[model samples]
Target: MKPLLELRRVFFRYGKRSPYILSGVNLKIIRGKVYCIVGENGSGKTTLLHIMAGLLEPEKGEVLLDGKPLKEQLPRARRLIGILFQNPETMLFNPTVYDEIAYAPRQLFDEGETRKRVLESARLLGIEDLLERPTTSLSYGEKKVVALASIISYDPEIILLDEPLSNLHPERKRRVLNMIRSLAAKGKAVVITSPDLELLDNICDVTLTLSEGRLKEGG
Candidate 1:
């Protein structure tokens, strides 16, 4: 099968004087697969993800979404890729949880479809009870769950989750992992970045390491 996303010889740096965070990085993310990118705190995993999500343009090389250049397919890329940044709750500004969850889908679907998607995603994330509550009133874990519900509401084909298991209780972490597996089962391409490398080894199909501005497969 064709890759859902591809990064070819990508290079990035914060600024002209700054050292490269990602240098000559290349990767292919396929549907129905779960990929884990393991790295230390300053390993540039987050930056790489931003490039994949089309939030950042690489200094060199290209990012392709389903065989087309991502830059050339911005609308399709936005519809196809869902990225949940670390502490994604920080990005949420809606008054209520339901509003937050329904926000993105509203851009692409009608009110009826958006409502259906929001409720379904909330149910899947076990946040149905929090729908009518104030988003600012939620606990950190609750906020995370709400944030995830929001991302999935649009049903993007490629999901990028950064530090998904961080600061969570073991049970919650397990639940998140299971949810990720379920997404892959439905043939979505899932890419995740985490410092906790060994925790996801059992479920990930491929593991790659990011270090000193480069990507290498395994461990």
Candidate 2:
């Protein structure tokens, strides 16, 4: 079978005036494995993740899924790829945690299925107790996991995480790591970007580093 996602000789920059953030980037994201991309701040890790998710197009080369260009397969791609951004809590606008987790499913699924997915996702992330609480009332860790629940509820095939362990407490960080491993165990393609490479050494199956606008294998 083809890889779940592939980035081939990709190139990107904000504008002609800006320096290239990614050049000749190539990667293959496979199912049932955890891939970690480590980079320092401003080294373009997030940019590459966005390109992989089809949120942004590369200036050159291609992002392909199942041997098809991602740009043409976006509608279907959205369901297959889910991205959890850094500081996800900052994007939470729902009144309650339940509403937040339910939002995406409600848009794509029937009411009964939406409810089931919301509850299931919350339970998976150990956030069931926070479902009825106001989103603003959640602690940072609770908010992070709840935001993660929102993505898991959608049941995407490929999950992209940006700085998942950043700013989280020790226990919350452990929870996030466990969740990543769990997702991979279920045959999902899990990709993560982090500045702290050592923290991820034990959990990732294939670890790569982004530096000087290129992605290199191994830390």
Candidate 3:
């Protein structure tokens, strides 16, 4: 079967004269599998995720979704992929937690369906009680959960989580890990990025190390 998403010989950098952050990086994301990318602070893990999510265009190679160029398949690609930024605060802007999670669903669903999606996502993240709270009032970890719920509410086929375990309490960390596993079990292509390999143990089906602008198997 064709990969759900594929990056072929991708290259990127911030400026024309800047050194490349990603040099000929290649990856294939498949459904039902969890991929963990372990990299240092400047290893371009977030850049790779942005390319896969169609947020950035690679300087050289190409990103494909279901064999079609991601640029050309953007409309479909947007509906298929969801990305959680390294800082959860960057993804949260709505007033209440319910409004935050309901943002995307409300764009595509009716009132009844939107409410159902919002409540279900909040329930999945064990943040049902947080629905009424203001986004600015939540703790960092709670904000992360709320951010994740916002993504899950739309039921995208591919989920990219950046530093998901950071700032989370041990219990919340376990909850997020279990949620990743559940997403994979349900045939969603799950990608997580972390600096620490130990935190991702037993959860990822494939662990890749990103260093020196390349991606390699094993952490």
The Cα local distance difference test for each model comes to 0.90, 0.89, 0.92
Number of backbone clashes in candidate 1? 0
- Give the CA lDDT, 0 to 100, for residue 74 in model 1: 89
Native-to-model Cα distance after best TM-score fit, residue 8 in candidate 2, in Å = 0.7
- Best candidate (score: lDDT): 3
Of 1 and 3, the candidate ranking higher by TM-score? 3
* Cα-based TM-score, every candidate: 0.96, 0.94, 0.98
The number of the candidate with the highest TM-score is: 3
Instruction: Tell me the spans in candidate 2 whose CA falls farther than 4 Å from its real position.
Output: none
Q: Model 3: per-residue lDDT, tens digit, 7-122?
A: 99999999999999999999999999999999999999999999989999999998988888999987756878999998988899999999999998898899999999998898
How far in Å is the alpha carbon of 206 misplaced in model 1? 0.4
Of the pair 2 and 3, which is ahead by TM-score?
3
Give candidate 1's error at residue 211 in angstroms.
0.7
